[model samples]
Each structure stands twice: as C-alpha cells, then as structure tokens.
Target: MPHASATARTNQMRALMGGAFLPSFLGLAATRVWLQVNLFASYTQSDDGLFTVVNNLAYGLVMVIGAAIALRKPFSKGNRTTVAWLGFAVMTFSTVLILAGKETGAVDILAVASVCAGIGGALGGGMWTAAYVRLGLRQSVLYGFLSLALGSLGGLALSFLPEALSYTVSMFMPAIALLCYQRAMKTDVGPQPAPEPIYDKEPRSTMLFIFGGLAVFGLALGISRGFPAGEPVPMDALQRVVHQMGVVVISLFIIWWFIVKRKRLSFSFLWRIEIMLVAAGMLILSVFPGHFTGLAIATVNIADTLMLGVLWITLQDVARHTTTDVYAVYGFAWASRVLSRDAGRVLIMVLGAMGASSYAVTAVIGIVVFALAASMALLLSDGILKLRPLFTEDVAAPARRSAAGAARETRRAEMEGAGASTPAPAAMPSAQAQPDPQEWFRDAFDLSERETEVALLIAQGRSKSYIAEALCLSENTVRTHAKNVYTKLDVHSKQELIDLLQNRE
Candidate 1:
C-alpha cells in the first residue's frame, strides 16, 4: 500500500513537471527571446530601430485576433489540441523565417513573419493557459511565475550567443510548448469537469478591474521600454543582466514569502504592494533625471515582473471562479493585455517620432500615465471588494461544504446512537399563513427549501450577505444555495434568475 501511494505521488510530480512547467518555460522563453533577437535584427535592418514597434504591434494584433477566435470556438478537448498543434507550426515557421530574414536583410519577410508568429503565439498561449487552469489557481500561478523567471534567465543567456545560434535554438521552443501542452492535457490529477454548466456573464465590476489593471500594467511596461533611453548609465551589458537577475530573484522571494510560505497576504494587499512598488520606481526615475541608473532599472524590473505575475494569477483566478470555459476566459484576458501594451507602445513611439525624446518630457509623461494607472487600480480594487461573494463562489467551495455537511451529519448520527436525547418536536406551524412566493419557485424547479429561500431573496433583489443574515446561514452556505438555484434553473446571473421567475406567468 505504501509503495502504491508512493508511486501515485511520483506520477503526480512527473505530470506537473512535464505539463505545467515545461510549456510555461518554453512559451515565456520564446516570447522574450523573440523580442531580444528582433531588437538585434532591427539594429542591422534600420538605423532608427522603428521596425521594433512594427514587430510588437504585429504580435499584439495577432494575440487579439486569436482571442477573438477563442471566443468563437466551443470549449472542447479536441478543439484545444488542434489549436495547440496549429499554433506550434505557425510559431516555429515564423521564428525560422524572421531569423532568416534578419540574416539576409529582407525587411518585408521579417514583417510578414512577425505577424504570423504573433498569431501562432496567441493561439498556443490560450490553449496552454487553458491546460494550466485545469491544474487549479495555486499550481497554475506558481508554475507560471517560475516559468517566466526561468525563461528570462534563459533569454538573457541566449542574448549573448551568436545570432544564428540564438535563433536556431528559439525555433525549437514551440515544439517543446506543444509537448508540454499535451502532457498537461493528459494529466489525471487536474480538475474534473464541472457538473454545473458554465454560463457566466461579464459583470461590469469584473470587467472594469480586468481591463483597467491590465491597461495599467501594459502601459507602464510599454513606456519604460519605448521611451527613448536617457543618457546611458555607467553600466555594461553584464551589469544590466545581473541587475535583471537580481530583481527576478527578489521578486520570487517576495512572492514565496508572502503567498506560498506565509500565505497570510490577501490578493488585494499584494496587488496594492505591486502598484506602489511600480509607482515608486517611476517616481525615482523621474526625480533623479539621468542619475537613475542600475538600482533604478532594477527597481522597475522587479515591479514589472511582479505586475506580470500578479496579473496572470488574478486572471487565472477569475477564470477558475467564473466559468468552465477556461480557454475563453483566459484568451479574452490575454487579448486585453496585448491590446493595452500595444496601445502604450504606439503612444510612446509616436511621441518619440514627434521629438518628445528628451528625458524631461518622457519623465513628465510617464508620471502622468502612472498616476492615471494608479487611479484605475484603486477603482478596480473597490469594484472587486463589492463583488467579493461572486468572486469567491466558484472556487469549489460547494464541494467542501458538501463534505463538511456529511461529516456533521455523521457526528449527529453517532451521538444519537450513543443515547443523546433529541430535542422535543415543536408544535406544527399553521398552514393558513400567507403562502410563500418562494414556495411557488421551489416547486417549479424542485429546489430544496433552503435554496428556495435564497432564490426568493435573490428575486426580491437581496444581496448574498443580506440573505445570509436573514436566514441565519453562513455566507458560504448562502452562496452554495444560490449556485444550486442557478444551476437547476439554468440561469447565469441574478438578472436571469429574476427573469425566469417573473416570466413564468
């Protein structure tokens, strides 16, 4: 029995290593490596490096297109696998063509290749994220962040190699991503298919947070990258690499200490810290003028890394909680991120072209952008707070409650068998009392009495907390009941629940 148990654990570990870790490593490594190699290509292709903007824009556009396609596809295993394989071919071919174009100075080929690669990345990334999400939020977030860290290190190493060698190596990443994706899909330990059908609506509050937070993150990263460099700091390439490595290390430590180890910090708290760090880095850069050097760059790098990790983590959390269509949810989120990033890049590129290249001008504009992003983040936080119940509902609390309820019932049975006296039966309630509007809905849908009570409150425009208070039930219980009500009635949102009841006549 012990050997069998150990064997099971070994299989689980292997699945995680192959499934979640490898694909993530390849995907992020490919992205960063592509950017780096393209930059090198740009140096030789054009004196002004304007083609970098085109490359980034191409990637962003394809990501958006792929997300739109994801929305149109039904969430099925077969479709996801097809998308992954197709993405693999496109990305691999594009990587090869772009490198070949760079070597031969074929500008048009590079541009076309960039667009095709972008499309492949979008399709592949969505499918990959879908597989990861099935592993649940914590595993997905952990592996995802680890992948980025490893990828960055790998990209940095590849940056030093000969251009041809670097490009050749990168061409293999999509194939690795495909393998990892397949492994993830074949895992036996992942989340089971949800029994309740997924029918989520884009709540205004949720959308506000997702779009706003991503915009803030993307814009900050874009401006930092595209804003014409100030007087070069007194640092060499090696020093810069070290700084980046250090920042990634520190960021990983912070995430581990707060989230994985201690597990005391809430998502809201961690998010606020991320914003503050980023804003602080920007402020330092602005105040110091050309003096913002190695430390400043490191600070910004750390903040950016944190923001990316947090954004993806939150996105996966949102997908996990809201629907079973993980691919669609993550794809939409990825599209928003890409669009926002490109928007910021375009703005900065235009400003640079228009002679706003001075350090002072860049700093001032950056500060303003950062301030606006901060405000949007605040609004997102408030929105999420107001909708906490909905956000927490889909994290599989129902299964936990079911197990707990069974335990409680078992304890009661044991007590009764041990001669514990039951309370005297209460007098029968009068049947002549006014009929509950709740009863009509309950009978129509075969709802439990508790569910019927929650449904009536929902129909009457009562919040989850209010229903909990009135019924003297815990909030988790209230949410569970409400979820059952929705599943049984085949409704998505509160409005739908009300509509079904009201239109019955």
Candidate 2:
C-alpha cells in the first residue's frame, strides 16, 4: 500500500507540472502556427507585405485596446476563462478563413481573419501570461522555453498535413489548452495583494521611455526577420526542417547550461546577448540572401523566441509590485510587444515595395538600428534592474540555505575545539528564546518563499557573490533581490536588514 501510495503521489506531481505548463504551450502554439503558415509560407511565392502588415497591425491594435480595458476591469478566474473560450472560438474561425484564403487566393478573406485572430490572440495571451506568472519565475521561464521549442516543432509538423486538416487541428489546439488552463486554475491558489502598487505612481515619462525603447528593439528585429520579396528558392522542405531542429536543439542546451545550471548571465546580460544575436542574424540574412538564408533566418527566429521569454520574466518582476489586478500590468506590456512587432512588419513592407535598391537600404538601416538597440539594451537593463531587480533568490535557495547551515555548524565545531563558546544569537525583548532567525524574518516581513531565503543569508553576513553562489544565481541578480529585500523590510542595506531581523527576534 505504501509503494502504491508513493507511485500515486509521483503521478500527481507530474500532472501538476504539466498542468502548470498548458497555457503557455497553447498560447505560443497559436502564434507559431499563424506566423509559419500564414506569414512565412503563404508569402513564399508572392508579395505578402500587405497581408503581413495588416495582420500584424490589426493584432497590435486589438491588444492595446483590450489591455487598456482589462486594466480598468477587475480580474477573476471566471472572466479570464470566458475570454480564453471566446478567443478559442474566434481564432478557430480565423484559421478556417486563412485556409480558405490560401486555397482560393483571396487576399480579402485573409485580411479579415487577421483582425479576428488578432483580437482572439490578445484575449488569450493576456490571460495566459498572468497565469504563467502565478506559477513563479523559474517554472514560468522553464515552461516558456519548452513552449517555444515545442510550438516550433508543432508548427513544422502541421506543415506536413493537408491545409484543411492542419487548419482544423490548429483551431482546436487553443481550445484544448484553454480547457487545461481552466482545470489548472481550479487547483491553483490565487495571488496575494502587494503592499504597494508599482505602476500607480509611475511617471508618464518613464512609461513612454521604457515602452518606446522596447518598440525600437522590436522593430529592428522584426524588419530583419522578414525575407525580402522575391522568387521562391529551390530550398528543400526537409533541409529547412533540419535547420530549425538544429537550432532548437542548440538553444535548449544553451538555456539549460547558462540558466538552469550555471546562472551565468544576469537578466541584463541576457538581453544584451539577445540584441547581439539579432544584429548578427540580420547581417547574415542581408549578406547571404538566397544562399544559406534558411539557416540564418532559423537562428534569428530561435533567438527572438528566447528573448520573448526573457521579456515576460522581466515584466512579471516589474508587475509583482502592483497592488491592482496584476494581469492589467501584463496586458499593457503585451500591447507594447504587439505594437512593436507589427510596426516593424509594416515598415519592412513599405521599404520592400520601393525597389531592389531599397533592399540594400533596408539591410543598412537594420544594421544601424541593431547598433542603436544594443546600446539601448545596456541603459535599459540598469533601469529595469532598479525598477525591479531580476537577480535574486532562485530555485536553489533552499539548498543554498542548507549548505550555509551546515557550514555554520562546522565553524561552530572549530570554535569549540579552540576553547571558545559560540554565544546565543540576538533575541528580542519580551520574547522567548528563538531558534531560526530565517523564519522570524519571514514572518515579520511577510516575505515570499524566495525572499525569506535571501534575507536569512543577508542576516548571516553573506556577500553578494556568496549569496548568488548559494542561490545558483548571477551576482547582479543577487544584488537585485537584496535591493527588493531591503525595500520590503524598509531598510537600506545588508547591515540595516540584519539589524531589523535582530530587532524583530
């Protein structure tokens, strides 16, 4: 019976993880299929600049409006589910419209579907992003990476299927994801209210600056991603699949190594890498044009998708401070993302329409913009860190604390051997003897699971590098978390934090 019970418990754990991942998987799948089939492949034989631009613009506009409305309205599980369901239905219809348009060469049908899919995607993406955040940062980032990888694979698989069948399946996929999401929400705990709203008093200039910078970065990447309008190359479908698969495999290993294992780059460094990849990718596409363009484009797409995950994680960190509906903050961010991507697509289409000379001009412009975006990344990363630090406590926090505890015991033993007694730690007035300052600090500040670990290490006189090593995070991330801990405890530095915890004892 015990053996059976253990097996049952393991199964439940697996189910919980899978359920947590459903929304991101489906939301990403929806967009991936739409882009691959409608934008990339459909336009291979003809000038799809108009269709692509309209579709992206319509998509962006809907998100902006929907996000604004969601801000004013209160969030509830039922409301989010309802929106997901409606989106599933509408987007499914749009998929069908796209299929018909492809078969009959009707540009009008495709255009209308763009508007419909745009609205549907905004509803679904906004809700799903909020849900992803509720899962915590590590799980959310892992799931996003998996989602993009699987979604890309899924898009490739769909390309093999007949148009009608693939379209039908694509339509159903989002609905299935929403169903899973509804089920997950049933078992999920709701978020706690933040002590203060971060965005409520944010300056208008700050908002504009941040969103505008993101738009510029997005535009540069967007235009670079699109292929110049031309005759279809004799590239084999098998070769393209191989290129994409290779990218996916390489990306997975890189993500696991840097993020999951080493925690090498801070959020700031990661964005810099992303921008550099975009710049390099565009240059390769422009220089190499027809030959090996598939490989270059695949590389760019993978980097772009990875960056999207980073962007979301950053936004969640920022939004965590909001006292209002957290989804509203995410909604606004998503709107910015949509607007940036669409604006790039529109700009590229306009440039492509001019002449072949404009193609070189586009490449030159992309290279220039990429340089500018790279510079902006450094500046903006610092700003984002100040607003909400990305590096702090992570998945390994508990293990790090255990190691610290063990080290403390070893040191105490060494002291005893030297004939020195380790005195009892500081205690509060009017309080009984307390053991773990960690728990005391946690309860006093109402810190989250992650923050509590950080505070305990800080109180123990751990350095930023030490805390980062223990927590399996980059030093910059540790600093960010320390800043957040100080803010929450209403203290300014590690000494003050330690003092506060001792006082609360």
Candidate 3:
C-alpha cells in the first residue's frame, strides 16, 4: 500500500470537529483551490525556465506527499472524500500563501485539511448534487450558494484576502450548504408510493445559477482565446489544434459520463449522438485548416457556449440519477486535471531534452486518434445494447421454470400439512412465493403501523425528501430510520426496496 497520503491528516481533521466546535474547513478548502492555481502556473509557464522548472518540481513533490498522507487514515477516519477536499483546500491555501508572500507553514496546514474538509466537500458535493437534481434547483439554491460562497471566499482569503475571512467562508459557508441539502433530501418523499406517483419540478433558483455560471465561463473562455495572434497560417493551425484539444478534453470528461455512466448504472442511452456530431464538425474544421474568419470562430464559440450548457445539464442530471458525490466527482475531475497536467509537464521535459516540435504534433495526433477510438467504442456498445433484451430473456426463462417447480413443491407441503398425517415442520416458501416488497415489509418484518407507513412510502418509490416531509422529520433522522428499516428488513438495493414495499410475492 502507498504509505504517504492524507490519512493521518483526515483523522486529525475529524478529531478536531468534536463537540460542535467545527474545525476550520474553509482554511482547508482554501488550500486545494490555491493548489490548482499554483500547479497551473507551474506547468503552464514554459516560457520562464527558472519558474517552470522549480514549480514543476514543487508540483511533483507535493502530489506525492499528499497522496502518501491521504492513503493512511483510519477505517471511518481514513476517508478519501474528506482528504481530497482538505488536500485541495491545502493546495489552495499554500498557493495563496506563497502568492501572498506568507509562505510559512503552508505545507503543514495543508497536510491537515488534506484529511477532513476534503472528504466532507467531496462526499457532500455528490449528495448535494443529487439532492439538487431530484429535489428541484430552487430547493437546493441555498446549498449551491453556500458552496460557491465557501469556495470563492476561501479562494480570495487564502490568496488575496486573509485567514480570518477565509475561515468563515470555508468552514461556516460549506457546513451550512451541506446541512441545507441534507434537510431538503429528507422531506422530499411521501409516506409511501401512494397509488399516485410523486413528481418533482425544477426550482427557478437552479436555472438562474446554471445560466449565470455558463455566462461567466463563456466570458472567460472568450477572453482567453487571445487576440489576433496573427493571421499566419502556422499560428492559425496551432490555435485550431490547441482549441480543439481543449474541447476534446472537456468532452472526454463530460460526454462519457452521460453515455457510458448511464449504461453502467442501468440507465438507457441518456445523451444524443447529435452532440457527438457537433464535435465531429469541429474536428473536420480543425484538421482541414482553411483559415476560418473571426466571425466563423465567433459562431463556433457561441455553439460551444451552448454546448457547455448541454454538458452542464448532462452532468447535473447524471449527478441526480447516480447519487454520486459532487466533491468526489470534482476529485475525479481533479485526477483528470492532475494527470493531464503532469503528462504535459513530463512531455515538455522530454521534448526539451530531445529538441523536437515533432513530439507536440505527435501528441495532437494521438489525441485525435483516441477521440476516434472513443467514438467507435460508443458505437459498438450501442450495438450490444440492442441485444440486451435477448440476453435478459435467456436468463428469465429458466428462472421462471425453477420458480414454477418451487411453487409446486410448496403446494405439496401445504396439502400434506393440512392433512395432519404427521406434525410436520413449517414449510419454507419457495423463492417465487416471496411477497411483494411492501407486503413483505408489512408481514415478514412485522413493522408497526407507522413503520409500515414509511416502508410503504419507500416501496411505492417515494424519495427520502418526500418521505421526510410526509413523516414530519428532518432528513438526517429520516435517513437513520430508513437505514434501520432497510437493515432489519434484509434488503440493499432500491429495486428490492420497492419489491418488498409492494409485497410482490
């Protein structure tokens, strides 16, 4: 096992949170945000020999150390989620500290938060993301705000601002956001899958945030595109290639989540190939290299703006469906970022060592080929997807036949028991005789009238939030009870949950 990670740090953070005096999660959060900026500067400043080499070396050392510490925490205490957030926080803090000219103790502070707030932010983000999508955007508005506020404040304070302000932004803001999301998820479900299904509507707050965020990203990307770097054909080709690569990375991160992630989670095709078509169109424009007018570039930019929206919505929805941790998602995002970044660094070092522009072009070609491979993989999977039902049938037939046999066996035992030829042991019901989930919950588990009410709600397909509201309890408490109910009832997945709720036997 890797010895150097954020394990010891996370345990320390968890311990520090005792008796309501929550540890300064913001300070930790600040560290991570700053780390990104520093790591970026380190890898990106290829023009500055001294800065680039030193920064890259720093980047490598920190990541190795952080990972080492991250991997060594206690079972409950050694949580990856917390350590990541805290690590990011530390990264942010250290970056800000160094940038702000107060480099003292930046590494140590980061070492600690790399443990706690990291997990909270990572896990909590996922929980909140799901809550937002399912509960409605308006419902989770406060949660988003709190998170943004936390991030922004920590960012500012750790670098430009000061620690006092950073503490409030990082610790209090995020904690509030998490609590709000937890509350919303709890009361969103009803008592049972009432004969009528409970439907959810998106809140206006989410729409506002989504639009606002896109606008900001657009404005930033536009600014970064750089002014007429010259009409020289070479420069044009370079920009086209780089720009295309950037978008490809975005697709690599976002598109597969919609396509492959959905299928992995037993969801049907969630995104349209039309989306991939746009990428195809861009690739053609890039490879052909006819100088596109600024107007054409502007048009594509707008399309990309829209494309980004599509990506964001896809991500939000995926978060909703999969109940994935937002921070963990971010952490995964972190992994992509770090790997890409480090690869970029290693490549540059090798290129400089060998003296070649050929490596850069080779890298671009490799990216294009990988993108093509990804497309083919999607096509092949879609084909296999079509044959899934046939496979389902192959398994279902034999299972049904066996179920019939068991039913016959049980029927025979019942008749013999009724005749009283002898006092026989109670006949065990066949698998097919299993009751529907709700019925099973009501009878086999002997749940109370109220307990049964809650079980029925869950079985009927009500969400936790709706259940909490109907039961008039906080979401956390509701989850606790739900956990107990699930455990006592001997079920794990929600499908099983529903089957039991309905007494499907």
Candidate 4:
C-alpha cells in the first residue's frame, strides 16, 4: 500500500508537469511553422503550395496558443523578482527555441509570421519583467536584466541575416521566455498601487530627464558639428577641455534624469515616434551617412531634425513605462521599428531592376515613412488624451491640490484687502491713495515718486518696460532708476531682488 501511494504521487507530479511545457512547446512549434510559411515564397522560392498552406494554418494556431498561454498567468509569488525570473526564463527558453530552429532548419518558415512571433515574444518577456519590477521585486532584477541582455543579443545577431531569415531566427527567444512567465502576468501581478495624480506642476524627474537628455544630445551635436570634419574641429587643449566638460555635464544630466529623477519616457509615445524616426534616420543615413550629394543630402536632412526632437520628447515616456504593466509594449515598439526598417530591404529586392532609382525610391520611401510617423505622432498625442487623466488624476493630484490651495489663499487675501478699504470713505481707494506711499518714496529717495514706484514695480515681477509705462518714465530713465534701486537695495542684479522676495528667508 505504501509503495502504491508513492507510485501514485509520482504519476500525479508527472501529469502536473504536462501543462507547464505543453504551451511553450506548442508556441515554439507554431512560431517555427508560421515563420517558415510566411517567408516561403520570398526566400526559399519553394514551389510546393501545400507546405505554404500548412505553414500558414500553423502560424495562426501558434498565435492562439500564445494568446492562451499569455492569459494563463496566475499572479503567484507576487513580486517583480519572481516576474523577473519567470520573464528571464521565458526569454531564455524562446532564445533556445530560436537556436533550435537555426539548428534544425530555418528555411521552412514564413517571413511575416517570423517577424510577428519574434515581436510577440519580446513584448511578452518585457511585460513580465515590468510586472515584477513594479511589484518591487528587486531580487529578480538580475533575471530581468539577463533576459534583456540575451534578447538584445538575439535581436542584434538575428539582424545580420536577410529580413525573413532574421525574423525566423529571432522569433522564438521571447516565446520560450513566455513559457517561464506563466505565473507573473496575472491581473494581480504587481502591488496594484494606484497611480498618484499629478497636475500643473512638472514632475521634477520628468523635467530633469528631459533637460538632461536634451543637453547630452545637444553636447553630442556640438561635438560632431562644432568642428570641421577633416580638420579635427580645432578645440586645442583648453577648448577641448571645455568641450569634454560639456559632454560630461550633458551625460551627468541624462543619468540624473533616467535614474535619480526616475522620470521615464512613456513607451507608447516613444514607439509611435521612434518607429518613423528610426526609419527616417536609417533612410537618410543610408544615403551617404556623413556626406551626400544634393538630392540625397536634402532627402536625409528631415530625419536629422526629427530624430533629435523625437528623442527629446520620448525619453521621459520610455523611462516610466519600462517598469510598469504592459511593459512589453516597449518591445513591441522596438520590434515595429526594427521590422519597418529591415522590411524595407524587401523593396530593394523587388525593385532591383531599377538600379539607381532603387536607392532613390528608398530615399523617397524614407520621406514617406517619416511623414507617416509624423502623422502617427499626431495620433499618439491623442493617445496621451486617454492616458492624460490617468497620468493626471494619479500623478498630478498633490501638485494640483497645492496649487489650488495657494490660489484660494490669494483670492482670500484680495477679498480681505478690498473689504479693508471702505470705498465710501475713499473714492480713488480702489486705485490706492495711502499717502500715495508712492509719493513718500519719491520724496525720500531724492528722486521722483514715479522712480520709487518703478523700484517697487521692479520688486513686483514686472518687466523693465512695464515699470517704465507704469511710471510714465522714458525707458532710459527707468533704466537709471533701476540701477539706483539696485544700488540702494544692495543687490547686484534684478534676479537677486526677485530671489530675495521669493525666498521666505
């Protein structure tokens, strides 16, 4: 009876293991078959229609499997670390599948399916990683990072091949990883901490990330453009030191923004913008990279401006989404960008007969892609509308409340001030007539009251010109008073004056 009990337990454990690997194995098979079919005509040029048809059916089936598996996450262990481990496993397993495909036979897959699978897997893994991180599973960070490293390696390595081949080569790594992520993708995966609302006040981290990213980027431009190409752009010793320092400053700023401020570039916005810009950059860069002839250079120039601006805005979004739910969205964006760029190669192959026009067509295509991306950006800005309230109701709440309180106080003070003045006793009281403290100041300063008034005006946040108009003084006269006021106030600059008033100290 004891032996039978042990035997039954062993069989039960064995049965339980089936569901674990079953989905992943199916996913891998689906990816392989689907990819093989999609690329069948384009790469292998095989004449068999039956194989192609069978592969297509297999590809669809794989997605169904993926969808099912993706939905199976049970939300257990409940930490980002667990998520990280699971995500890493999924990623590694997918990569192994990819390796298996390469070893067994990659030529049999459909190109489009391959790209889709690869993209799906990357996203799946990223999604799981974020779930873990957001849940505060720091211990699992190593695993998440490992998945990223391996996934990146696979992406880059696979990129070297023909588009279809690369897609086929790349598809499984994430799928395999997804296998391991079953427990992490649950609805209850993270801490489920509600998003904090934010309002008018800019996030310190966001501003920091933006300025820092821009500064670093700007420094790069300064370095690359500040000097002549062949001449080494003559910043001898001292200048070089300054330039180097500038780069350091920019780099430091970026680090502060990305890490310290924890201001993230949102994933959705980045993807929307990055897809088109990356395509544009590749197109433009393809023309001559560093140098180009008239039309070519002209063609690529749009990309340069767009790339910088896109990077400037999207960095914030990317930083934040990289850790939250649907984290794989970032991977999806990257995969889209990668596919869009690489898929362009297909056009080259199709139009190979046109020779120079082929390249020209590519240039034209780059422009079109850029325009499409711009349009997409416009569309995505609307996406922000949907997310805005969330980002607001959640992230901006405190700041908005604080501002509201301040505004209310200001209104209260103004009401009190108005009530304090009995207009019945004072007709111009609305205009203020207390010794025209304005006039007393004029007499005391050995200057016109208007000048004193201007000094007071400068103290208030009014610009120099506003003060001139208010005092009925010429601009030059106002300037003179400003200088005198500065001297009397023992302030070196207007900024000092403003700072003094603004600071309670």
Highest-scoring model, TM-score: 2
Q: Which candidate tops lDDT?
A: 2
Candidates 2 and 3 compared: the better one by TM-score is 2
User: Model 3 residue 229 lDDT?
Assistant: 24
Error of 4 at 240 (Å): 27
Sequence-dependent TM-score of model 2: 0.69
Off by over 4 Å in 1: 1-49, 190-202, 228-235, 258-260, 293-298, 357-385, 389-505
Residue-level lDDT of model 2, residues 296-319, one tens digit each, is 555555555666566766676566
lDDT score of residue 168 within candidate 3:
32
Q: Candidates sorted by TM-score, descending order?
A: 2, 1, 4, 3
TM-score for all models, in order of appearance: 0.66, 0.69, 0.33, 0.33
Off by over 4 Å in 3: 1-74, 77-92, 101-285, 288-363, 378-505
Cα lDDT computed for each candidate against the true fold: 0.58, 0.59, 0.37, 0.37
CA shift at 155, candidate 3, in angstroms?
A: 12
Give the clashing residue pairs of candidate 2, or none. Answer: 391-477
The digit string of per-residue lDDT tens for model 1 on 1-505 reads: 9997786566545433322333433354454444444432412211113444555556567666655665676557777778788878887888788777878999888778767766665665666666656654445545666766766676667756776887788787777767766776676544332323332554567666656766667676555544444222343455457545754685577557533442332466656665666566566666785565444544555565556566666666666655446666666666666666556556666676677746657664655466457645554352353434321222223554455456546656755886756532232122113223454566568998788778866764567776775576999999999989999999999878765764564
In candidate 3, how many clashes are counted?
78
**Weakest lDDT window of 10 consecutive positions for candidate 4:** 226-235
